[model samples]
Target: MTVYVDNARIPARVGRTSGRWSHLTADTVDELNAFAAELGLLPGWFQTCKRKCHSTLPCVHWHYDVTDKYRSAAIELGAQPIDIREMGALTTARRAALSARPKGPTP
Candidate 1:
């Protein structure tokens, strides 16, 4: 299970917040959550795409929007830092693979 971070320069200027931020994603939600947990991010910080909010819609991906400091820490900890273009393709493939899986029986 690998975690990925986009190489897009920090977009700190666009947001009202004070620091740069980056998206942290993984091949699976469990992997993503675990990595975020290692980063000391709370469970509440986990975020999924809008589609993931509804059962009928395809779940795109799960991620954590992390600050620049955390971004550096993530990379140091073995997260693959990738180009923004590559990041898009990676996420697209991850989403497709995730959505194609068969669901277990509902409780």
Candidate 2:
């Protein structure tokens, strides 16, 4: 039930918009989405792999790219801060667990 944010020090120059950004993730999609909701993020802001060919890719992790301001808010709200190097392993484990679970009817 933990949410995670990377330690990336995003520079405003990285993107067209003038703000730092960080990647927000969790061990489960439900937890991730809930945290994002708590952060007042729009549902459309959620990012994941959409291509069928990439469905089995371990590199396809679910997350939200949040700005520095939002990152601070997320930390206040209990998102665990982690290094980018740690993300790959965390994401792989999470994705595996998610894939093994039985699917339920989509609401």
Candidate 3:
């Protein structure tokens, strides 16, 4: 699975970090997490659910929000740079995969 980093440089502050941030995502969650480890990213830093993670919803978005430093490192580490359209396609595919996941007993 190819890892992709978007060109989004939105200004933000996470914890003590303050800088433009980009998204580091992959074609699969396993690959994303594995690559994140290579980038020295903590498992806690991984973002999947947008709102409450405890919510009984399929978390389709799996990515690491990388600051400028991490973004640069990601690019240097061979993460493919992608555009907004590419991101949309990726998200759509992820959502579809989520929909296809085998479901358990409905509460």
Q: Best by TM-score, which number?
A: 3
By TM-score, rank the candidates, best first.
Answer: 3, 2, 1
Writing each residue's lDDT as its tens digit, candidate 2 over 66-105 gives 8888888999999999998888778767667758876877
Q: Is candidate 1 or candidate 2 better by TM-score?
A: 2
Give the true-structure RMSD of model 3.
3.8
Q: In lDDT terms, how accurate is model 3?
A: 0.84
The C-alpha TM-scores of every prediction are 0.75, 0.76, 0.81
Candidate 3: residue 53 lDDT (0-100): 39
Error of 2 at 87 (Å): 1.2
lDDT of 1 by residue, 1-107 (tens): 78998766576653565677788888778988888899898898897765554355466656788888888999998999988787778867866676787788767
What's the best-to-worst order under lDDT?
Answer: 3, 2, 1
Score candidate 1 by lDDT. Answer: 0.78
lDDT by residue for model 3 (29-95), tens: 8899999999999999898776743335567667899988998898899899998578878987777
lDDT (CA) for every model shown? 0.78, 0.81, 0.84
Which residue pairs does candidate 2 place in steric collision? none
